[model samples]
Target: MKTITVKRLTEAFQLEVLAGADRMDRVISRPRTHRPGLEFVGYFDFFPMERVQVLGRKEINYLLTLTVEERLLHIGNVVKYHPPCFIVTSGQQEIPYLTLFCDQEGIPLLRTSETTTEFIAKLDGYLLKALAPELSIHGVCVNVSGIGILLRGKSGIGKSETAHTLIRRGHRFVADDIVVLKKLGPSTLLGTHNVTAREFLALRSVGLINVVRQYGRRAFQDETRIVLDIELSPWQENALNNELEVIPQFTEYLGVQIPHIEIQLQPGRDVAGLIEAAANNWYLKQHGYSAVDEFMKRVEDGMQQ
Candidate 1:
């Protein structure tokens, strides 16, 4: 299981330490955070002690209503299970007894300046990205216009070169060679290149070149959800552009399927232009239009005449 440390959270969010500052390296084994609303009222049954507990405005106000000893008793029962940490959001007035109890229990008590809602949203998003299941695929992903197209082919099949051409033509580079895919959602796979090699793309003889340095920031994208899979095949005379039927194709990765297209590679084939057209075609299809279907309808109507 992938576990993130409490120290990482503090560093990422710049959380101020209230207690147990020495226990920053404690692992947050669970991805989901919790609001111990029930635990505050002495309802300890089924308390999720493994998650990062949050004390928002309501909980802090409720605790403030209690007598000093009562507050300690309730906080004592809550932290007795030894949760990973407690985050005091909304920057409310400090509850010294709660911090004192957490300090004694060696549980990290941290506070963020952001409101409870905003902070939780950001925290969950970060945790999800950090801990999502990962899969590395062999391909080059690019953003054509706004479409994320994954170019797949065997080694030395011009995947890198083709992506380079697209970059020159104003498209964005996503990943090259090995694309790391994170299953961020049930049907969404986010793909990105290795950070160490993020700025570079390779082509035979020419060697590795930094696209960002060459083309500026607009030519590079950190990650994209692959919306199209384009496979490049060696040119076959008479076999290329032979599809008469207008059926759509799809490819799958980590249980998510996206539209698919194939383009044959040959001298003067205009492969880059074809890919751009494919992306535009995909946009058209999404908006209830298909060039092939429309062409077929026109042909059928003409034949009847």
Candidate 2:
């Protein structure tokens, strides 16, 4: 959600403008910013607004081909260009007029030792993130085989304990304590975790313990396609009405609709077994079978007979 600006770019790197130094401080229109009425000068100008500019050997070669008038035109076009911010690539190339202009105009004149290709590839990522706004949040997730599962409940509802049990039973933990949920596209949900917190699962018996230390790194998973959810709560048979023949449905978390299953918990119950059953039932549904509906059909047929 943070917008990258030209002023921010100037401060990030050592820059030395080759031309149009006077216009260095001018605002370049960023396609990411989506500002109106701005033009960009060169195809190679995909630098981050926050990057330091450096010169490469090839750019000097390009500049030598122009007449003074043509050179001025290119500089003028560059100065007048909008959006994509500029960085001359490579190290210590002389363009005195441009450098002086940059100093005077307050445009960033960055100089680096990296080749243009490498610099562009590296810095372009920052600009892309600035241009394209994506939302990321932290939470815990798991991949029950291919079925992505997310567990959420009150602070002490055994969320981490349940996740740990699943991991020991050969299910992969996507995230343990804190899970990050991101929207991939319309109607799609993806969840992952920070590396530092990925394998760390908390338990009521102790605080946070490292899963990798206890179970090894293989117990953790990078990410998963979240297809189902499990919300742990103290079991209440009376809470669920008879008309509710199916798992209660929920389609939104952090504002996204996902298939959800409310797993009401109680003492002395096999929590891991419940999770396994849920995954298996979901798998059956994925393959076009529904146990509840099938049972309902059998009951109706029996009544008719």
Candidate 3:
């Protein structure tokens, strides 16, 4: 039930208010828009009331063909449905009757200079992002070798410290501390830095430092699609010795399963190097090469020989 107010849309799209200024507070709950071409001729069975109604060149021309009384009757019928708002595209001219009816009914009527197709395309994209499902996770996201790696584990496990080391090695930082994950589609999850902590990393000894300021623009990324999840945990002897003997692991986020791995942490261990190697290994797996699978195949060949 997320909604974007008409006032917000006006500001975002720079829409011109032709009428119904008092209705700027109207809320738009649906990202999809509706074109009332068929409904213009007295068909209301399939008319969508929750979507923003669009009036383009063809719709306006058709309204002109009707006599004043017929036009008013038709427009009044549509207004009775109480749509969220009406947007006029192709901004060539204004239909006085339509504007008047919308004003009287207190329905926001907005005009845009862009063509029908362009306006709809942009509006759909904007709405999709604005209404996409989002969730926050306590982890660190980084872009290593063009692959997004999300590091997750208990606090004090050196997630930020590992990320800092990776940053020094020329990898791009996506987010630290709080990672905001948004479902871009059925299968895609996009991760970005939380607004309050963008480009800032917290360290026990150094306190808070801005990574962007320290490393410049090349060290930071606005967002990245998460492809790998690595969990850092306290070292348990021989816990991961059989990792290569088992099937690869995966973690589910927003209904999509992503490749997952767990790395044990201990003092003096090269955590950053291990993560970097994992990223490279993930890249190779994506391109049809897996070291574990290859090694197992080699063992089978040797046994046969």
Q: What is the TM-score of each candidate against the true structure?
A: 0.89, 0.59, 0.85
* Candidate 2 per-residue C-alpha lDDT over 1-305 given as tens digits, one digit per residue, 9 for 90 to 100: 33555555555544443444445454443332221112122444443433333335655555566676666655555444332344666675566545554554456555557677776666654454344323444345888877888888878788788888888898888786677665554566777776677567778878888877888777877777778878887888788545626745875754667778777887888988888888888899889997778989999999999
Model 1 CA deviation exceeding 4 Å by range: 42-48, 244-247, 296-305
- Native-vs-model 1 lDDT? 0.87
lDDT of candidate 3 over 233-302, digit per residue (tens): 9999877666565467899887878888888998899998988888898788779997878899999999
Top TM-score prediction, candidate number: 1
Q: 1-305, model 1: which lDDT tens digit per residue? A: 77889999999999999999999988887767889989889887788899899889989999989998888888888888898899999876667888889889899999987899888888888888787878788889899998888999989889999999999999999888889887778778788887878978998899999999999999999988778889998888787556664467888787888787888899888899999988998889789997778989999999999
Of the candidates numbered 1 and 3, which has the greater TM-score value?
Answer: 1
* Residues forming the 10-long window of minimal summed lDDT in candidate 2: 32-41
Candidate 3 worst ten-residue window by lDDT: 238-247
**Which portions of model 2 miss their true places by more than 4 Å?**
3-139, 194-196, 241-248, 292-305
